[model samples]
Target: MSPQQKALILPEKQGNFKVGSRSIPSPGIGQLLVKVHSAALNPVDYKIQDDGIFVTHYPAVLGVDIAGIVEELGEGVENFRKGDKVLAHGNPSIIDQGAFQQYSLTVATSTAKIPSSQSFDSAATVPQGLDTAIAGLYGKHLGAGIAPPWAKTASDLEPKYPIVILGGSSSVGSYTIQLARLSGFYPIITTASPNNEDLVKDYGATHFFDRHLSGRQLMAAISEVTDSPIRIVYDAISLPETQSVGWGLLAQNGILVLTLPPSVKEDEGKGRKAVSTIGSPHVPYDEEIFRSSWAMIEKWLSEGTIQPNNYEILPNGLEGIIGGLERMRMEQVSGTKLVAHPQETK
Candidate 1:
């Protein structure tokens, strides 16, 4: 029999989560077998369990943010070696790659070494959020088609262009704010509860507004921050209300990027556009940008160019994830990622 490991499994579509066992998978080419130390929860995790939107297989494991130590490396994987601490965005569609397990396989191209400045729990909060930000900002097909800051011609471009991010305190929103700063977008405007004002500012938001404001009210408020046109509005929350606000704030010929499907209709006469972005590196359209950004993860974290989201560690390890997901569904968690230790599961 192959080696077995503990996993949090969903037995059927929209099924309840339960602790179960699965065999540890071997590292295939260009992959690493990791002993998962921390797995961070996202809104999508509960959505999958509730709506069964992504996974097709039964007895599925679902989680995407992972930070762990590499137990073994597959052929053609040269950048990482055994025992290297790393963080990766897991693919919940694949059972072997799901993060809600004691051990999982990670794609080498999408994995990055975790810098000493970060702990496993903190690092686990980054992969999915950061990838979503990268895809929404830099992906031509999946996002606003903005030029990446790392590109050679990026320095020659104009700066001080204003951008707005709805839900600045969200994991995706927080990373989007940081990357927008690096891309030289000025007067970085964001919306969040007033309590998270300082937190979003630390992430590089130049202007913060109360998220409860209506679309017209938000537009009026943002006008005070910058007279420049708002060419890009990233609705990290992407709820119908937030999308309405983002669409209202976007200037003619501007783009509205959404993590969820757009609720606002685009008008060709106005030349306004709406794009939905999927953050997975495995997606062919987003693969290039994800690889480019993942390459810089270590340096960015080490230099503090990118800061991990605030995280709350869940108790009782993997079993604790159930309550955490429920809290997320109830809108109880705010401005923080929920992390679980799979190895601590009993």
Candidate 2:
């Protein structure tokens, strides 16, 4: 590999990212130097690009999801080795920054072994959204069959039962559907634009309601699917319209899990609850909760339980980051992930 590698660089806030080369750093303690094969773009990527609130250093990288092979392991790192395939979400809180680079360094706990059946692009797409799903759907009880990384016991029963996933057509919603199915939840219901009803159905949604449909009609559709009340709910896109509709759909004694902020009262009737299902290590930008999700998803991906959704590969490596971000900003990229590839300089 070449001593210098190219990465997408955001020179400043509201700036267009350009391609530039930098020296690839060697592994540090408990870190791995990965030769990134691909980096998946998320809605947050465009948000960060627009605001640049998290850019501590100039010419910073801005991708979050990464898939690659471990090029070198830092001292005392035993779980991986040179050339071992892996996938990880580069935690933004750490000084390490992002993955829109050829070589990225990340903590071992934040990565997982990628399944052989999945491509680097697909593997890159799974970690962040899947982690969100694990957090939103299973929460603390992820170990009980659909156990997320934080589960300490496998005997825990479903909490705030009868969870519903709002925006089931999203990447996070896809995983929530799969995990809910694996967790033995009956009658998983979801809301999407009417066009995506068939796609949501393919993801194992027992019932599909259109977000554009009237509130009365949506409620009637949901009611026909389940005899029990809806308890736990995860809203991927926590916009006011989605949450307002989702909250009204929640049954008595229900708990709402929102990726964004909630619009309902803190407590519902009959011991019901509503809270944003945020990951742990919440203080001052710690992502310890994400670490747990990464590990648990590794096992699930390997077992073929979860699958990555539609994606479009972007060529020209990090140079293409701007174009990809532009497409997402305009909401042109829908139901498909924009992934940038960064190969080793041979």
Q: Using TM-score, give the best candidate's number.
A: 1
In candidate 1, the residue pairs with backbone N, CA or C atoms under 3 Å apart (3 or more residues apart, or in different chains) clash, namely none
Task: Give candidate 2 regions above 4 Å deviation.
Answer: 54-57, 93-97, 140-154, 158-161, 263-273, 278-292, 344-346
- The residue ranges of model 1 lying beyond 4 angstroms of the native Cα positions read 154-156
Measured on C-alpha atoms, candidate 1 has an lDDT of 0.93
Model 2, residue pairs in steric clash: 142-147, 142-148, 143-147, 163-232, 231-255
Cα error, candidate 1, residue 155 (Å): 6.3
lDDT (0 to 1) per candidate: 0.93, 0.73
Residue-level lDDT of model 2, residues 1-346, one tens digit each, is 7888887777777687777878887878888999899899887777777877645666677777889999889998998888989988685544343788888987787778887788898898886777677666555432112344245465755552455788888888888888787776778888888888888888788888876776678778777777677766777778777777677777765666777656766555456556665432222332545555666766777777787877898867777767888887786865677888877322
Candidate 2: residue 249 lDDT (0-100) = 76
Which candidate wins on lDDT? 1
